[model samples]
Target: MKKSIAVDMDGVIADTETHFLNWYEREYGVRIGVHEIQGREENEMFPDKTVARKFAFTPGFFRSLPVMTGAVEALKTLMKSYDVYIVSAAMEFPQSLPEKLEWLKEHFPFISWRNIIFCGDKSIIGTDYMIDDHIKNLDFFKGTTIMFHAFHNVNHNHHQRANNWDEVLKLLVK
Candidate 1:
């Protein structure tokens, strides 16, 4: 039996930070540097506290996100050695379920629909390993946790860290 790994969709495989930065600049005509966002929550990245929520709730928001660098290839490689599942907290955003599935189909066609999990709480997951950006999810996971590095999560040292797909490959692809 293969060891299963549950991977978060947002900050881990999807370039949500970049999406926010780009959209923020387009909407506000103000460019926010990544350096300015360290240790801040996603909603706190903008001067207007509600902007992030608006962006997330906007149509095409999740579907238009860029794929994280090297994620496609790294996941493909990892799939050969482990049972990889793409898991996302899509219940919070009513429109995210279908958008996320479509995005996955476009960007990661190799992943089966059966392995995709869209849920509100990740604690129910029973994988052998989990990669996530949120402390809330990882904190409750019973498996080995990998904190995927994002500007928001930079200060957290609660779990093993992976700064990029290269780092993730090094940690779990062996």
Candidate 2:
């Protein structure tokens, strides 16, 4: 039987931070560099918490994000031997599920609808491997956890780290 891999969508596959930074600059005229994002909290990245929260609540923020580079090709390679599932904690954003689905349909048409799971909590997912950018999801995961590097998880050191999809492929596809 093939090993099952559960993948997180946000900071892992979707470059949400870049989306937020770009929007923040265009909308608020504030420039936030990767180095300036020193913490995990979204509000910590900005001088105004309200602005950060406001941006998150915006209608299309989650729906419109660039896919992380190399993620598609890496996933395609992994799918050859792994039962890959796109798992996301999307219930937190009431408006994101549909948009996320649409985004997935556009970028990852090869991923079947049956392989996607959008939920509030991810601890219930049992798989052989999991790649996520958040510690909250990876901590309870019942498998080998691969930490996809993101600004929030820069200091996280408990699991194996993959700085990019090329590193992820080196660690998992072998």
Candidate 3:
């Protein structure tokens, strides 16, 4: 039996940090350096917290996000031995469902529709392993939790960590 792995979209397979930086600079004309946001959540990084929070609600925001470095190759490698599923909490922003689906189709054509899960909560996922940036999601997971490194989660230290997709391959693709 293949052990299933649940993977997050934003800040995990998607380069959400870079997305924020690019969009923030474009919208506000103030470029916030990566170092300035380290160990801080996205909302806290912007001058106006509401501006950062509104980014996800903006149309085309999810579809235009850049894929994380090495994510596609790493996931393809994992798929040989694991049942990998892209699990995202998309209900908060209802408009993101279609955008996220389109983004996945564009970048991860190999992933089947059955393997994509868009739900309000991740606690229902029963995979043997999960990789996510949010501590809130990983906290309730019964499986082995691997914290994917993100600027927002730099201060977290409770779970097993993978700083990059290379490290993820090292940790799980045996």
Best candidate (score: lDDT): 1
The list of candidate 2 runs beyond 4 A from truth reads: none
All candidates in order of lDDT, best leading? 1, 3, 2
Candidate 1 segments whose C-alpha is farther than 4 A from its true place: none
Error of 3 at 140 (Å): 0.8
Per-residue accuracy of model 3 over 78-161 as CA lDDT, tens digit each: 999999999998899999999999999999999999999998989999999999999989999999999999988899899999
Model 1: lDDT equals: 0.94
Candidate 2 lDDT, 121-172, residue by residue in tens: 9989998999998888899987899999888888879989999999998997
TM-score of 1: 0.98
lDDT of each: 0.94, 0.89, 0.94
Taking all chains together, each candidate's TM-score versus the true structure is 0.98, 0.95, 0.98
Candidate 2: deviation at residue 69, Å? 0.8
Q: Tens-digit lDDT track for model 1 on 53-157?
A: 999999999999999999999999999999999999999898988999999999999999999999999989999999999999999999999999999888889
Which is better, 1 or 2, measured by TM-score? 1
